[model samples]
Target chain A: MKVGFFVGCNTAFNRPDLEKAVRYVFPALGIELDNLEGQSCCPTWGTMPSIDLVGWCALGARNYAIAEEKGVDMITVCSTCHGSLARTAYRMQTSPEVRNKVNELLKEVGREFRGTARIRHAVRYLYKEVGPDEITKLLKHRLDGLTVAIQPGCLSLWPKEVFIDKEEDTFHPKVLRELCEALGVSAPHYKQLLECCGMGGMRSTDMEKSFRLVERKMTSMKKEINPDLIVTGCSSCLIQFDTSQEFLQKKGRIYFEIPVLHYMQVLAICLGAEPKMVTGLSRTPVDNIIKRILQG
Target chain B: MKIFEDLQTTAEIALVKNNLAEEIKELGADKLLQCNQCAKCAATCPLVLAGFPFFNKRIIQAILIGARETLLNDISIWACQSCNRCTDLCPRNVNPYEVILATRRMAVREYALPALAVEGIRSLYDVGHAVYLSESGNPRRKLGLPEKPPTTLSFSNALREVQAIMRKTVLADLGIIPMEESANF
Candidate 1:
């Protein structure tokens, strides 16, 4: 299957390894990724209510327009982009009134959205096209000696219909568990595994709310389930847990020094992909485990 | 502030009279009517488990009885991580997260909530991405990402899809459809 790639802002920059891993594993599994260099950010998290909603819709619609222009299906690495584009496609495809109104607004700017493409996040792409059983067969090594917790940020789930089947419930989404099994790791049960990182739009202004939310997750991880690393699918969750852990430590509630990583990095490890190639580890504290997996 | 003051009260009807009632009925009040308020939803809520005072049953009961005042005035609604744990576990299917979302939406419509609260909503425009980063430099470069070409979306396709839906749904009368593909397809 030929799948087009929409590299989200975070992956393209801080987490380039994710894109690298995608390139590494996807094609090998018979999934061809066509990169549309013109693809833009999902812009859902950047929006503030004070700004016009019509404009956000236009930006999101513009992304779809680019993919349609390429005459290929859209596959986004970022959960937020997937949600934004999916919501835009659904609204535009299902509600002509909204479509017309939005188009009227876009017309003033010379952008038109005909809704020709379908949007799928990378998780869905892997689950649906690659299949877990197929992915399991590709593992180069086992992820033993690792007690990882699965953190599926809100963007990945909730709009449940748009995603792949979870291996478990929203809190214990089986997607990551299945991914872990294929990679040879033990995914222990953890509370709030699918909770929000609390670093949504509020991270900029309301630092306290963001901290409070992160602290809660960290505290729970310490008291409830202690894992060597916290595995995540969302960049924002990576930011909240990996970056925010420093903040929580200052408050004298340091339960653990867990490193958070994108699940793709784990997949790359199983596929024998290098650690340095995966991005977003500058702040992560679990370098040893990752390096151990890579070296072996 | 005053919004929080009015919301901290116990009287539902009185809170509504204080103009704290949102355009949409908030969650947590209908418990007496249909909800047993047994704490099951809260027990399952990711936010609650994460240590926030976020209770799905409380929010549900508040909204079931038209306690718009309390729902509108409360700040917990804003703290929802949108995990939707309550939506999945709600034996009654009350969808407290949606109620909280609606309440927040109403708050956003009437008064300016926190700027970040609206950032997700505003991100559709100004910056191509949702979380506002510096607009001056290349976004990819600023975030330590590899530089890439800017992207463009097809306006016509989305417009057609929206138009088709408008024709089918009740939204047809509003003429909310875009005027032309170039301007409002």
Candidate 2:
């Protein structure tokens, strides 16, 4: 299967290792990756989407047009990108008025919104296209009984009307859990599993309150599951969990540090990719997790 | 008894029936009035749990009552994570997230937005990406990847198109960023 890899800003800049992991794993799993050159930001929820509907849809159409022109569906590792782009496509396809307005605006940029390409998150792609059974067969190293706390992130399961891969039960999602299990890791249930990571625009708005949300989530995970690592499907959540643990510790709020990894990074490690190349550069130290994966 | 009377008088004075709901509908949240105040949104809302004054349910009620000044004065609207969990769980399909966005749009028009939100918008216009970091290339280079990923950062033509599209929207009218022709990428 071929797909255009929409490496949103965080993965491209903030965490290139996640991008590297995607590059390593998708090809290894027999999915061709196109860079979807000249794509812009998903514009994020706070940027264009907050401004106006037409502006949001127009920007999203421009990104979707890039992959539609390439005749391949777009896939992103970031939930915000997946949410923003997929919602735009949904509006364009479902609302003719929106499509016409967006297309009229796009005429200036010399593009059109055809809604031809499907937008998929990387985990959903792995779950739907590359089944867990196939993923297990491709793994060179199993998780070896590692337990993980899952952060599915809000966008992957929300506003289910727009997305192509809606969780059967969004309130209690199984895709992320099943994906982790496929790699032989135990992703146990936690009360705040579906809570926001307090990332995205909230962190920019009020760091303290945002950190409080993360603190609540991490406290729940520490109290309930106390997993070896925290795994997330979204890049924003990955960054939030990876970076916030240090702040939470320094503030004397939390006593323990839990390692965080994106699903792609874990999949890459399980596929035998170099840890430093795919999972390094995390703010929270991942050395112990790396040692566990390599030796255990 | 006197303090309670004063509070009641203030609430009565604060009530104004403006076209706030109508304005939100124009902004694409046509379901603002459909909210039943069920608090399902508040149940999952981080802003509400974080002790913010106005969250999904309250924001909808405030808008329903045309509490424009009340909303504009409070910074709670800006703190929304836009997680859309409320949107997912809303049984009436009220889409509380869109309601919040509609409120934010009203806030932006009133020039009531926070500086950080303005910065986020500015970053998107200036760099063609909302979260662009100049030093990010160093890490990409270290990862055996191109210094610039194949985005608008690498393609000036695409960035220009993005800028051109922005120029036609209400963004140009908002004048949040300089949308002049010379501001070309």
- Local accuracy of candidate 1 as per-residue lDDT tens digits, B10-129: 335444564433344331222222344546668756455445453566765565456666665656666555555565666655555555555555555555356455443333232233
Candidate 2 lDDT over B1-185, as tens digits, reads 56545643443444345677788888888776666677899999989777788899999888777888999999888888878889888977889998888788888888888887778778777767888888988889999999999998888788888888888889899888776563443
Which candidate's TM-score is highest? 2
- Runs with alpha carbons beyond 4 Å of true place in candidate 1: A13-30, A45-59, A92-96, A103-116, A136-142, A162-172, A201-209, A219-225, B1-22, B25-77, B87-102, B109-111, B117-124, B132-145, B148-185
Docking class of 1: incorrect
Fnat for model 2 comes to: 0.82
> Which runs in model 2 stand beyond 4 Å of their true positions?
B1-16, B182-185
Return the clash pairs for model 2, or none: none
The Cα error of candidate 1 at residue A14, in Å, is 4.9
What level of docking quality does candidate 2 show? medium
Report the TM-score of candidate 1, chain B only: 0.53
Instruction: Tell me the lDDT of model 1 at B49.
Output: 44
In order, what DockQ does each candidate have?
0.18, 0.69
